[model samples]
Target: MADGILRRQIQLAAANLSEAIDGADGFQNTHQSQHCESAKFSIEQVVFILEKIHIMWESVLPRSIYRRSMFHVLGPVFSRITKDMLLIDDMAAEETLQLQGLIHLALENLSSLFLSLVENDDDEKFLDHHTWVQLDESIPSLKKFRKLAELLDMSLKSITAAWESGELANCGFTSSEMRNFIKAIFADSPLRKECLGWIVATPA
Candidate 1:
């Protein structure tokens, strides 16, 4: 019941925002930024939900199938749903030209989560724990982020490429924020420097 209620609420909120966004100007048809700030709120909310679900996939999912089948049974299905929602957010952003604002933050969160898992990855215990059966950092995980990045790329192409290229100047993160996120999660590693560099260089 709670899940159903939450889904309904999200659906309603998305619908309301879609209507309001369609009516928004400049951010929609011109270089004039109007509703971007508000769109940031809605896009961030959706991004948070997707990020949580992605993380939960690690903590959930049965292990027996993962080891025996070498496949992500539930990960793809959930990922698709998350991807579609993010697509909607992206389409809205494109119409409004509001890229790398709130949606970017969501991708950052997703990337950070993936980077954290990768940093702490224990090859010895990989899937034996049965806790993260559908995560994307293991055997066939989808790197870190997906749909969010696709949208970001569609809107902001160079920055995403810069990030993938591991260019510190294009990491897509901020200096202080990158420092803090890296220091806390990545302590001492090549990836720590790589990610920080990309973030610092990533253009807002």
Candidate 2:
């Protein structure tokens, strides 16, 4: 079925993105650009897959279901992912750190939404059982997104740690300076609130 194939593609893309993020962790400043390019490639793949999945969901689900609040919530999140992918190339290291945080938060929200759908049966009464089953088939990919979120968080923390220990001197800022700089930038940006909202908001 087309739905099954799309789900598999999403899973594969998430797996590839996770692997690329992991690979990025092993590089220093000298090789960081290569890893960044690799990670960017994977991210673009994920964005493409997600865009396809969004289109598929819209096509396959009933209009009523597609218009549901829960389904609508994902639209902005997917848009953010695509936008972030486009901007990744232009971001400085500190900007990329903030972007990673936003990505992790967005993925966490998506994962929570999927988990809620998987665990709750109340939707079965409104949506037909067949449609519910179709949605359920994508749960594995949702779980993969959660795992990817955790990995992204870990990668960001590792990079911060390296900076703290002066291990990233070649990248220019000392640990304390980078920390202050991030705080100042994020403090002024509305994105900080948006990312926090994603992290703390309940699934619809």
Candidate 3:
């Protein structure tokens, strides 16, 4: 029963996180006038889910269990999502480094949290505070990435961690290959212009 609830909560968290991240303006200079409505809609969806979640858990689990474990487990992940979206949407060029740093840190933290949960031998046990994200790729179902889209829907931080930890890459590739891959993924993305400008500015 607890496991089921945990899974459900994980899914809801991932969905809200995905919507928030996806709906956020990609450009640093996007004005609120352009983004206000989407932002409001995304936040409202998350709040609605959260309110229902509070009610559902209140009914299903003991008060002590909800207070002790769910709060701890959900809070960090929730905080990470909020920070990630805000950072990703920041338009100020002066804060680029700060944004990147937040991106790196949040992803690592979320990854660690996920690894702890997945590797936990006991489904009912709560983890300690400082356990780091493990690089283990043998985690089944997760290995094939069959669950990646859904997992991303639930947790991009862990997804980023998994990517940075090399669960997604098959072999070493040259920088050219990496560049080509990036171009393919972001060809129509906002990053496309940046990539083109870099290429144009580079020496032959």
lDDT of 3 by residue, 79-181 (tens): 4443333334223332333333333443343443344333356556443443222222322222222222222232323433433455434322223432343
Best candidate (score: TM-score): 3
Best by lDDT: 2
Of candidate 3, the 10-residue stretch with the lowest lDDT total is 140-149
- State candidate 1's TM-score: 0.31
Estimate, for each residue in 1-204, the C-alpha lDDT of model 1 and write its tens digit.
244654554455445434433332212322234555554554555455545544543454344422222222223423432333333312332432344344355455545443334333455433232333344435332322233344344413343354455542232233453245234323357655665666566544
Q: Rank the candidates by TM-score, best first.
A: 3, 1, 2
Runs in model 1 lying further than 4 Å from the true structure: 1-33, 63-97, 112-204
- Candidate 1, after superposition: displacement of residue 63 in Å? 5.7
Candidate 3 structure lDDT: 0.41
Q: Flag regions of model 2 displaced more than 4 Å.
A: 1-31, 63-204
Model 1 lDDT-worst window of ten? 65-74
In order, candidate lDDTs are: 0.40, 0.42, 0.41
